[model samples]
Target: MIQRIQSVFLALGAITSFGLFGTDAAETEVPVAGSEVFADAQYDVYDSLILTGGVLAAGLLLLIAIFLFTNRKLQVVLCNVALMITLAYAVYGGVLWYTDSAAAQAQVDFGALLPVLTMLFAALAARYVRKDEKLVRSADRLR
Candidate 1:
């Protein structure tokens, strides 16, 4: 059960990393000089990557929460890591939001929300795992 949980976590981590770091030729475009509308094409790409990563992380964390009882220890530790990562991502998104225009804030908000949700789910999963662990230990003592 622990091995399976680790595999799933590793798979999620791989997919999220690829989505965050992979460059898509289809998504890139050349910007014309003095074109105010498309001045920050690269930044847009970066934002898209961040948003994708956040969504993937959130989805994975929710899945982990749903399966928290399968491997309590591993899931709890993974949840802790996910919580920290999401918090960091949220901080980065906040900084971006403050530095950019309203349109960029929209993008930042989209990215920020996912990490926040991910953290929430991870925290919940950790709580469930810890509770279950305690219950199991108490049951063993009574045996």
Candidate 2:
């Protein structure tokens, strides 16, 4: 059961979540007061404790879910919870970018997409876990 497809998906999700620490979610150009130069500011998950903690928690949840393959129901629930956490952090990052008045222009980076990928992987894993549960229930009924 540990070798199932859902476990693979959960692992991928965890990897992507952990990958956030090394990538910049967004880049902004801030004009310096009394100067013609614009300063480049990059924001990543590590920039805020809330973001950093949320990402780390999400990654840990995915990793824990992988080992819970024997409990398909709980694994699915964990995947969904992790998905929610990832979404929250993604939105939080977007809000930070949007609320920064000093930012003249913002560019989305690969780090911004990692949370989306993690969510996708989590959803896929949950779907497969549900499928496995259904198959098991049906097989039991056949006995």
Candidate 3:
């Protein structure tokens, strides 16, 4: 089952989520009161309780879905859930950028796109899962 195409995609999705956990989510640059130089403040997702929980849950869900080879329907549902979690993470990141920009300098780093990649992988995995389910059904009708 681990050799399945969907499993590979799920693995990739999990890996990307782990990257989200390790990398810098965003950065802000603000000048000191009397200095011409600006200092960068980096935000890591793991530092926030909510973000950390959401990201870890997405990755774990992928892993759980991978083992549900016997239940294609459940696997598809879990993958979709994981996809939503990643999408929510990206939306929250945008909200932070929008809200933070008004008060001070805020720059969204490229790492913010990691959740997008995770979503793509999850979507691909779910597609393959659905294909497999359909194939199984068609074959059952023949026998």
Q: Each model's TM-score? A: 0.55, 0.89, 0.84
Clashes of 3: 0
For model 1, residues 1-143, the per-residue Cα lDDT tens digits are 43443344444443443343343211115543443323453333255456457545645654554455466787678677767766766566556545543333222213223344445555655665677688889999999
Model 1, total clashes: 0
Clashing pairs in 3: none
lDDT of each: 0.50, 0.85, 0.79
In candidate 1, residue 71 scores what lDDT? 68
lDDT of candidate model 3 versus the reference: 0.79
**How far off is residue 84 in model 2, in Å?**
0.8
Candidate 2 has its poorest 10 consecutive residues by lDDT at 31-40
Pick by TM-score: which candidate is best?
2
- Model 1 segments beyond 4 Å from truth? 1-48, 61-68, 101-114
* Tens-place lDDT digits, model 2, residues 58-118: 9999999999888899999999999999999888877766667644565777888899999
List the candidate 2 regions with Cα displacement exceeding 4 Å: 29-40
The order by descending lDDT is 2, 3, 1
Better of 1 and 2 by lDDT: 2
Error of 1 at 68 (Å): 6.1
Give lDDT tens digits, candidate 3, residues 37-88: 1123666675356678779999999988989999999999999999998888
